[model samples]
Target chain A: DVKVTQSSRYLVKRTGEKVFLECVQDMDHENMFWYRQDPGLGLRLIYFSYDVKMKEKGDIPEGYSVSREKKERFSLILESASTNQTSMYLCASSSPPWTSGGNEQFFGPGTRLTVL
Target chain B: SQQGEEDPQALSIQEGENATMNCSYKTSINNLQWYRQNSGRGLVHLILIRSNEREKHSGRLRVTLDTSKKSSSLLITASRAADTASYFCATMTSGSARQLTFGSGTQLTVLP
Candidate 1:
């Protein structure tokens, strides 16, 4: 079975602080993603990495950045956290679409971040 | 922008009854997927229906896709209290890389 693990289950940070959320997958998948879930707005993609050092912005990527220095690890970085960024952050990993024919994604237990 | 939107944002049903949720997308998609999320946890992939296929089933869950209407529906048979969760529909647009656009999701509650 595939396993995706997040760095934290719950986190708290003060305004203007830098925050990092980490995700690691054991399946050696080539694709990884970061998303934020908020009521009414749902899960919105923040950023995604197709391979090491490759990153793409999603619909809402203004205040966030991502790093994928290793195939098994993906990190989401908030340069300066704000209260608006407080939410449940989720990470997912999946095999390349072409190889698996759009395989299902494996998600980690999300990290609920509170920016105060 | 969100490509898919789920209708009947909240649903309440009793055990043994079937629960149905609908999702509609705006653009052509390569495939659609259904995911389930408990209260504050991450999502779990439930099922995926290709655009060329009309209907598919797994266990007690049935999924139907209509390309003409750009919509899909998920039916959970013999629903139980444990089935309560938020269900979301995600779309992988044709020609897109590996990203999926997710919908707002429907919160379903099953009472014993």
Candidate 2:
């Protein structure tokens, strides 16, 4: 079984603060992703990393940045957290779609961030 | 947007009853996947049906895909209270990007 773990399950931060959310996967997957879930928007991809040091912006990546210094770890960074940034953040990892034969993403439990 | 849209945003049913949810997408897709999420948690992969396939089943879950209609349906038979969760349908398009587009989701509640 694949396991994806996040650094925090819940977090609270003041406005304009810099926040970091960490994720680690044990499956040695090459693809990792960060997403934010809001009430009506569902899950919107923030950023995805295909390899170490290689990152691509998803549909909504303006307010967030990501780091993939190692294969097992991916981190989401908020440059300046705002109240609007409060959301349930999810991290997922999977083998490269072409090689995996199936594009099934395994996700962590998620971190509910509250920016006050 | 290649995002799939789930119909009947919310569903409520009694235990031992059947529950069905439908999803419709806008573009051509290589595969469509279903996921289930409990409250305050990340989603878990449920089933994946490719465009070339018509129907697939896992345990009590049955998934059907119709490329012509650009839609898919998930049926859960003899649902239990533990089946209550938000279900989402995600699409992986035929392009090279390999990004999965997700729908808003359908909240299913099974009463005991």
Pick by lDDT: which candidate is best?
1
Q: Which stretches of candidate 1 lie over 4 Å from their true place?
A: none
Residue pairs of candidate 2 with colliding backbone atoms: none
lDDT of 1 by residue, B1-112 (tens): 8888998899999999999999999999999999999998999999999889999999999999999999999999999999999999999999786989999999999999
TM-score of each model's B chain?
0.98, 0.97
Which lDDT tens digits does candidate 1 get at residues A1-116? 89999999999999999999999999999999999999998889999999999999998999999999999999999999999999999999999887864468899999999999
**How good is the docking of model 1, by CAPRI class?**
high
Q: Which whole-number lDDT from 0 to 100 does residue A58 have in model 2?
A: 94
The alpha-carbon lDDT assigned to residue B98 of candidate 2 equals 63
Error of 1 at A67 (Å): 0.8
Ten contiguous residues with the weakest lDDT in model 2 chain A: A93-102
Chain A TM-score relative to the true structure, per candidate:
0.97, 0.96
Cα lDDT of candidate 1 equals 0.95
DockQ values of all predictions: 0.84, 0.74
Best by TM-score: 1
Tens digits of per-residue lDDT, candidate 2, B6-102, equal: 9989999999999999999989999999999999998999999988999999999999999999999999999999999999999999984468999
Candidate 2 per-residue lDDT over residues A1-116, each given as its tens digit:
99999999999999999999999999999999999999867899999998999999998999899999999999999999999999999999999876754499999999999999
